[model samples]
Target chain A: MNQNKNALLLLTGISLFMAACGTSKTGLITIQEQGSFAVGGKVIASPGTFDPYKPTPAGQTFHGDHAYVFYQIPPKARKYPLVMWHGIGQFSKTWETTPDGREGYQNIFLRRGFGVYVLDQPRRGNAGRSTAAGTINPTPDEQQWFGTFRVGIWPNYFEGVQFARDTATLNQYFRSMVPNVGPIDIGVTTDAAAALFQKIGPGVLVTHSHSGGMGWLTAIKNQNVKGIVAYEPGSGFLFPEGEVPAPIEMAGGQMAAVGVPMSQFMQLTKIPIIIYYGDFIPEKPSDNPGTDGWRARMVMARLWRDAVNRHGGDVTVVHLPEVGLKGNTHFPFSDLNNLQVADLMSKFLKDKKLD
Target chain B: MNQNKNALLLLTGISLFMAACGTSKTGLITIQEQGSFAVGGKVIASPGTFDPYKPTPAGQTFHGDHAYVFYQIPPKARKYPLVMWHGIGQFSKTWETTPDGREGYQNIFLRRGFGVYVLDQPRRGNAGRSTAAGTINPTPDEQQWFGTFRVGIWPNYFEGVQFARDTATLNQYFRSMVPNVGPIDIGVTTDAAAALFQKIGPGVLVTHSHSGGMGWLTAIKNQNVKGIVAYEPGSGFLFPEGEVPAPIEMAGGQMAAVGVPMSQFMQLTKIPIIIYYGDFIPEKPSDNPGTDGWRARMVMARLWRDAVNRHGGDVTVVHLPEVGLKGNTHFPFSDLNNLQVADLMSKFLKDKKLD
Candidate 1:
């Protein structure tokens, strides 16, 4: 390989890379209005705020940790509000545009006639920035990020070969990674979801990976919620195949917090539930579950589905590989096949008469 | 681009392509007595040779279709053989090496400790040339091949954006395509399959797409068929959701060639049945079915699944997209996700105690 040839190869690779990108400025659906708003936060005093000697008072303080929700309503929407809760380390941006730069689920959902509400959950992304200092942060390492999501086990790029087949795509995928501080504050998330439902009225809930449990929590909070579609939610299924899943986490109103089993959360059984697990989940030793987290979640889901259905709750538990769909990561909605997965979820919602 | 730059780019592309290839001659699994042998052919009388001016009377001739099979018995193999039957237009080669030059299912099965038998069914691939001519001839065009196989619907490469996202890989896929000129003669295929089982002894039948129906026919042919994992089997699911499927085709001298409704598939109940349909199948309208053929097949599958389950048949019907695995074409086996899917299939067989 000569210098001239190498230069041309670089140019060629650059050209190919550039070709993968496209503008998301417009699509078949037009947004009636799109804007951001804030809700729910604790007041914390800052050291100084335009006061040289006198710091801000305790009674009148700055609002921090409030979730910032960005919403886009389609002019010709048929379905009510469809709130999207992202996974860990992700925010509203996850649903706005993909790594490949195409219109993300927010737009896709709107185009398909669902009013989209993308939530910036607490302690992550947009919401984390507004929090008071001292977040229990960890190093924002790509390897850790990939592992936590059960993306794959890899000492290097050679492993999980199917997940990220090419180096070019891998580069782009890493660019989309973000950092999260401490553990998720379930109370804050539940409140955010509740406030959104209160403001927009509940319709359907679409939660992905880490946010899967959020759908359940939010549904418990809002009575207006019609149905839920959890895409590999952080929510755990039950243990031992047919047993009831552990109770949903309940925040104390003003006292001790209590756990509420899904069955006791009577509203859950009223609506249809569909839980989807992507392909290549480690059923055997070869598959990666990061720390057996994903496998546990899947087992929990299976148990949940059985419990729910047995209790007259409409539930569909899907393991992607069982259906012959492989190579799907935790984030199926953002994969090369995102649109297809969305379509499948949309159908489930529609079939349940949620839409 | 200038001529100098263009020349460099071409050279660069060639070098990059050459880099992707590696010797398949060696891998984790070692080949054991791998070669092709013919089965079933009719003996006919022909004009003799050695006399230039006058033809000699009645010499021997062969008339039967040749069945070429390549077998590799593993060192520590399972109790029975694992036979693969390809769909239309494919042969044993479909299971030998993938389009991308990776290990194919036959080798994968062998690696997993199973004695593998790959069949080149009559009127397809290597078996096509061996058949006495004038069989139901049909042109195997690339255009039809791409479409019928559900690769994508493209009048040209410019359309169906998802179909050819990576032109490099798509080109590699096309290189693996082989031509088969003709409609399959069911009698010949059934005979060939029966002959194979007779020699190898009945085991597990792993059939893909068009040959899915063959699994059923073969199960009818050999009493030793322990189980079946139909990867989009050609046998259509029935009509109106409740109708019985059409009768299985039978060769002459088979006393009972009657069509059995799923309800009467008592044999199916004894063995596990797994049907896999890949992603992006249009229950709606955006996906491709190549003149709706794929969709029709899927519909038939759904009906078949429902009836089988109703009749106490141990059937698992999977529509890939439904489980959040998307963007799979008819050949998930050759997709970037092939190995993962194989892993899932292997697990299924093991679960059923077939392996």
Candidate 2:
């Protein structure tokens, strides 16, 4: 072809690549802090971008966004977009670092030709809560400690109705981006994972910790999620009937006390689900060791399995002793040992790779 | 007692409890980033009222000091302070958060009544490497790729000859404070661990990785340590005969080329020793699958065991498979599903506690 014609073709290819890449809206959303606050006393987001201002309307508050550090690798063949999420108070950077200081899981994925995106939660990562007079700073250590202990993030982000709405919005975003990058059929489990799968039609779902609740909500509400790998997902059934009480969520400006009906949640969904827990339980209320919670988790798994079998749908439920799939009681994704979790996750999603 | 004397005694009791409750330090070293530089960039340290900045000399640079966040529980007693050093590019904060977002092993110790101090290495955590004036900015892709793979601050902080000197200084400081804090037996292995143990009058020397080299050096040259726990310690014998490398020194000095002789180093100390290794083989060289390295470690272990046995001392070598410790790789400390190495470490330490 002539030089001018070749240049024209090049431009067309570039445009096609950009269009095929997908639509990703990168911006900052900040949530206002309640009560009196001080300067230098805010939680700034990691990677530093999104900011939420204060004076949030009574019911319309709690707006925020998270950024994913994206890296595209070689071997331009069809592949799955790998989405990894960080635990509470941690950024997506945790998954990428090894104890010995080697490249994180993202580097491994990128090197192996997988597109990697590390997800930050709305109030987590670089998205910080707004301070008095509209400034972004990381929530105070007091708030983080409470969040770590499960009292929930101060002015909890993604709780009650806002949680469901945020879930749907995030899912829509993931689905809309799938066409540009590749396919979402690879896997989804955490809030982003389930949302991505639910948005992109059908795929696997992997849930951990509080997000385990998200998995149940998605499986019950969205038909597109085909499987689940629930890692130490928090559900009422996991606790002794009267020992650990149910999580309290507020709806319509009143506290709505509800127990996690694990068996019912499982029965509501028809898909393969794997429930994983850590064996080395810490001395804590939630982490009650010796598989105290396993019985409940098992019951949920069994009920789901039986329902699928009755309907002639294929689903498998297996216990992962070698996998520290769920973290301790806090955030499952923060476990430094998640390399094995990722390995197992990779295996679970291998056959489902997108063309 | 008189009324005034009785009141004085009560006040004294209260003061004692408060003093024993928590302890603070002065002359604490503080580290901070000069500016944004590469993750593994060479770390520079200088002394300045423990301030974050104030340059002194080229060779005197080190990372800033770190505060140990500790909790004391009852029953087991929270007196012993286990000084911890994270691997490359990591801070103590990561260890504080478990996978599922609960407190991890360090916290496990706290629950069991143990005080732990996890220190950050220089040029890591809040202190990162700064760029030279007018350095070019990396491309967006390069930032994602290179930035994601920075080394842990510890490695960058204590390296070459500076590591040995720092270890010595830290040991003396701990020894001086041990009387006030309870017992300050230094426990480290691997390069930093070994280097630290060597500088102090060692109690039990636990060395991992390149720290094994330092252990041999301490054994042959310094006779301070009481016991030894070598976890997958690299072997000097693995090198070709007559090709052993020499001791790297500061002041731009070069000495004898042959490295420390393990055979000779073994002859100096009759300390009790225990060695541990993992089972999963590495799929790649850089993957750190210590499964293969175990055999090499075992060879070294056997030599030590035989030597100790002949000398009428005690030494034990336990392979993972024999103990049912499965799915563990080279990085046993951070293994998600299996913390076999750490479990064994605690068991060994428990014995020492009794001693």
Candidate 3:
């Protein structure tokens, strides 16, 4: 009986090891535990198209798409092209429209010579902001699939994940419809870029926010990526150990969410990363097991440090106190704050001599 | 004779009009020229390859070829990818790493959760830094054919405009590479990130500084880009009208080599952009050329305002005397006096929930 037990134990250990390596496909799962935290409501589902500056054509892939906010700056140059992405909420448009009369980040990049693009993160926004809706929205197979998913703060709300995926596809397709924009598919884009490198080679790529993980993954995957200048990338998810907190921040107060594999991007990608946490210093009450932002920042920093230590490259972690921003909340990309952030980025871009 | 003269005048005017539109690739070039300037440089050629980061492996399509510092920041997840196309004698690495220390705008994103990437910039770097005895190093074009280049800055000789085609090619390649680091190119690894979005989709793109123009061109060439965030991008060489000075404090003693297409990204992409520049309130005579970074920061603040007014974002420009930094060079990301730049980016990223 004892011999049999030992053999079983050994078999289990080996099996676990194999699973860990193989599981990289779905990434590590992040589990959120309900705590004393509560928010406005359960998420609502809505089908809406949001374009800050204008509207998309009905047949356009991005048509009827809900957006947090879509904005456009007067055209600066033909060399410049439209760039857009999704924010956390189903629609990031709310953040774009600040009561403070600040210019949104969209306009900021516009004036400087960038066409702005943003999409409504599917199933997020007012759609998900339901009164009693719990933070984690479950999919049809919540029981079987809920606990096993990772990346975002919430459980694998089938719609939310679908929404994110849709955003990517739509953005890809939408770029094709826009004049002067590049091709749609990722393969085409990268292959074309690679081909271009063959003819005239090398350049830059850009990204932001939750998209940072996606962007990082994309950049590393493509050999042509030259450098990256990410702003406040959501890398906290990379760490699963230590004092884990809620995966996201709720309006009411601090919330506790399960950990997932989305955070694994940092661990997986050794590409140089610079994590930014808007200026929000925690006070005495900071240790309240509720707030997740503080913990997230620390974890991100640790992850970056570890990456740098392991890999000989430059990765920095910055705390922007001047802007007084907290993690992934309403963005300062509105108005003066937008300019401030833009200025710093501008300087960095110039200094780094990216291309 | 009078009628003939009148006819001739009308014909001349018509020809000029056609030239204005026809000569420009994009019909809106005239309007985009409203905010324009020039930063010039020679394009040093370097051998190109599918694997610029490493030696070309067997079967790589893009083997030894012409190249240049193409892009910065992978399309992963960050505000923007900023490219710093080095001036004539400057290579991508030099702009990133100065003799003094690691100084370059690329650091801005690297510290802010950005996936910063920099190329040898084709012909520029990788070409022998030392000129051959009794023979001028081949111009970028000649070098491309010969397939030779070196790394780092080649001292006083900052070449500009010698490799316009190379620049365009670099832009094209990097633009194509966008999908690699973005949601579209989900699971690939320059980093070990899984293609999470492949099951779904991609996000956004951002760029900064001199790379801003490159970003713009990349966007225009490769339309899949979702959003852009350019900071202090160089003005349009094509439209050299309302050019602004590089901040003296930021530029330090040197100004960016004249006439490179940083700001021109606006015109190229016709995309939205966010720009930022410091208002240097100069306090010393040495800072007379306020564009140079020799002035005291207090004084640099005032100068920064002018530069911003002349060249910053169309949405908003933040002139912060309080946030003013000193003893820095034109490279905004290289600010040592105040890491506020990094902090600012962090705040914005966090606000965007990118952190």
The best candidate in terms of DockQ: 3
The DockQ-derived docking category for candidate 3 is: incorrect
Q: Candidate 3 — which residues are off by over 4 angstroms?
A: A1-84, A90-101, A115-209, A223-226, A235-273, A283-292, A322-330, B1-26, B29-355
Mark the regions of model 1 whose C-alpha exceeds 4 Å error after superposition.
Answer: A1-28, A44-59, A129-133, A136-140, A148-150, A155-168, A181-183, A236-264, A285-291, B1-355
Model 3 — TM-score against the truth? 0.29
Query: A221-318, model 3: which lDDT tens digit per residue?
Result: 45444545555454423333443444444222442322424344333344444445443334333432223344454455555456444545556555
Chain B TM-score for candidate 3: 0.38
lDDT of 1 by residue, B1-355 (tens): 6999999999988654433221122322322222234444333335443221121232322233545464656444688778888876555545755555455676567667688887767544334333333222112234445555666544343233224456444433443332332346766777778777786776888888768876776676676788888887655232232354554322111111225554335566667888888764556332233525455566667667776677676788877667655666777665556777787788888888887
Better structure of 2 and 3 per TM-score? 2
The deviation in Å at residue B225 for candidate 2 is 5.1
When 1 and 2 are scored with TM-score, the better candidate is 1
DockQ head-to-head 1 vs 3, winner? 3
Model 2 chain B lowest lDDT segment of ten = B26-35
Which candidate leads in lDDT? 1
DockQ of each: 0.01, 0.01, 0.01
| CA displacement after TM-score superposition, residue B251 of candidate 3 (Å) | 72
